[model samples]
Target chain A: MKTDWKFILQIFLSFLKIGPATFGGGYAMIPMIEREVVDKKKWIRNKDVTEIFAIAESVPGAIAINSATFIGYRLAGVRGAVAAMVGVLLPTFIIVVILSMLFLIVKDNPHIESAFIAIRATIVALIVYAAYKIGMTAVYDKTTLGIATVTTAILFFLHVHPVVVIISGIFTGMVAVQIKSWFGMSIKLEKDELNVVKKEKQVKEA
Target chain B: MDVLVELFLTFLMIGFVSFGGGYAMIPVIEIEVSNHGWMTTQEFTDVIAIAGMSPGPIATNSAIFVGYKTAELPGAIVSALAMVIPSLLIILIIATFFFRFNENKFVKSAFYGLRPIITGLIVYAAIKFAITNNVIGELSWHTASLMIIFGLSLFSLIKLRLHPLFVIALSGFVGMVLY
Candidate 1:
């Protein structure tokens, strides 16, 4: 594929807008990403976002970065992927670097330290909230809930590395489906995407 | 240069292994960062918090932070690049080999289990952060306050249904004011 700079730049600019606009990280940028990618830019189909979420989440890294790369690659080959990746990361990089630098200067200040003290506590709540929100959709059945419970126990109690946990999850998911099939049950994977993933906040891949 | 290479390799390892969003990488990151004497557990929490409050992914944000601490702007730049390199390579390989593996039954079934495990991974991250940050280790006035804030944040997100951005922003405000 010939590297088209113009389209690559467009992809970059599109995600540049998305990077700094998102907050609270994780899947928080899904709706905004959809707006830039599928709705406004017309770069991809509506349903592809769900598939992208699965692929991005199944592998290592952030959903935001993974989807950016995946969509970028889909749009304009490797150039497109690079454009989108840089686009998405550039704004956040600049902002975070500035923040981190500023934090270095003020981290030990009594006031800011106190603020971080509380902020840290609230962050725990935020992560837990993420779990709760995603769990609502993910653990819809006993099998799924069982997977979640066992996984949680292992990660928490054993302090197992998350990569290992993720691998186990994939294995368990496949096995769970196979076991169900033994009893003549089948997993309807894609038919229900619209209902579960169509919403803004609920479509999180985290 | 030595430190930069270390930073690159360390985060490269993290980027490759991370799954279920950057939150799941917390434990892995903590160990690596501490082992390298980059930061203490307490300091890493600060990185996690900033990463959370910022836009983009936590893994990327952490890379930036660690990079900055090591070598300023250039260090930050390299670390950021290093963080995404593994995923970039993986995706490129996927694009080459399985351009459209989304419809594969084996993959779909794997995700069936993965979705909930991600949920669990995230929950584990939260609990670990709480313990590391001293929010849950010992119960006292400080822990009590932390619990109250945690409850309020949860309520705002779940019941009141506030957006995460607002919840985090509000938490920062309350943190500055109360704590």
Candidate 2:
């Protein structure tokens, strides 16, 4: 595939333009990306956008960045992937760095300190809310509930590394499913179900 | 140079297991941040506030903030790249060979196990953060006000569905007024 500089530049600029709205990140950035990449640029079809999102969500890392790289790769291979990745990253990178600088400068101010006190409280709430949201989807069955409970217990009492816990989760999931199958039981991943529900809603809306 | 390498490697490790979105990565990031003695839990919460208010994924945003706090611009760049590099490589590999990686039964089972654990980790992250921030213990008017702020924040987020940025800004103003 002969990748033109102009095409790469277009990929970069399109993502860069979508970069600032990525404040909450993940799925929040999807509509905008779809607008720019599929609806506007016509670089890919609407159906391909759905496939990109499916893969992007399943993979590790931010969905926004993952989809960007996927879209770029589909269009122009490795170089296009790099172009899209850099493009999406650059705006937020600059903003965050500048914020870091500004934060360091005024952090010592008493008023700012007081404000941060409240902000910290809100941050905790945000995390709690995050857990609630994930829990709704992640903790559906008895086995899942057990996994979540044990994970918390291990974190609190055992003092193991979180990565260890995550790796354990992976292996545990695999083994658990295998055992369940031996008993002729089936496990349903809620995310797939969620996708189905979403598609149903989309169809209804259409 | 050694610090930069450590920063890169730390975030690279984080990037690999950072499933279930940026929030789920909080506990892992918190552990590394404290292990490196980069910041205190209180300070980490402040960093979270910054990351939450910023315009990107909290995982990468905090990585940039933590890296910058530790080793300046180079650190920020290295950490950011490290965080995303795994995503880039994994994505490319899947895009190339296993377009149906999501449909692989083994992969599906792995995620089946991973999902609840991700939820568990986030719950733990919340409790740990609250403990470190003194939200879980101690008693004072300060604590009382903080609780009120937290309650309101959670309400606004869940019930009202206000954007987090707006909630943060609102809480900051209330903090200034109260404190």
Best by DockQ: 2
lDDT of 2 by residue, A1-206 (tens): 55598988989999999989776755667788888998799999987788788778888998888989999999889988999999988888898898998998899899998899888889999999999988887888899999999999999999989999998888998999999999988767655455522464377458
Q: How does residue A181 of candidate 1 score in lDDT?
A: 88
Provide the lDDT at A148 for model 1.
83
Question: What TM-score fits each model?
Answer: 0.86, 0.96
- Which window of 10 residues has the lowest lDDT sum in candidate 2 chain A? A192-201
Which regions of candidate 1 are displaced past 4 Å?
A26-28, A37-59, A183-206
Position A75, candidate 2: lDDT: 88
lDDT of each: 0.80, 0.88
Query: What DockQ do you compute for every candidate structure?
Result: 0.65, 0.85
Superposed on all Cα atoms, the candidates' RMSDs to the truth, in angstroms, are 3.6, 1.7
* Local accuracy of candidate 1 as per-residue lDDT tens digits, B47-166: 877777678788789889988987899889988998898889989988778656656789778778888888888877787788887778677888888888888988888899887667
lDDT (C-alpha) at residue A90 in model 1: 94
Distance (Å) between predicted and true CA of A172, model 1? 2.5
Error of 2 at B96 (Å): 0.9
Q: Identify the candidate with maximal TM-score.
A: 2
lDDT, candidate 2, B1-179, per-residue tens:
49999999999999999898999998999899998888888888888888888887888999999999999999999999999999999999998895687778888889889999999999999999877776767898878888888899999999999999999999889878888
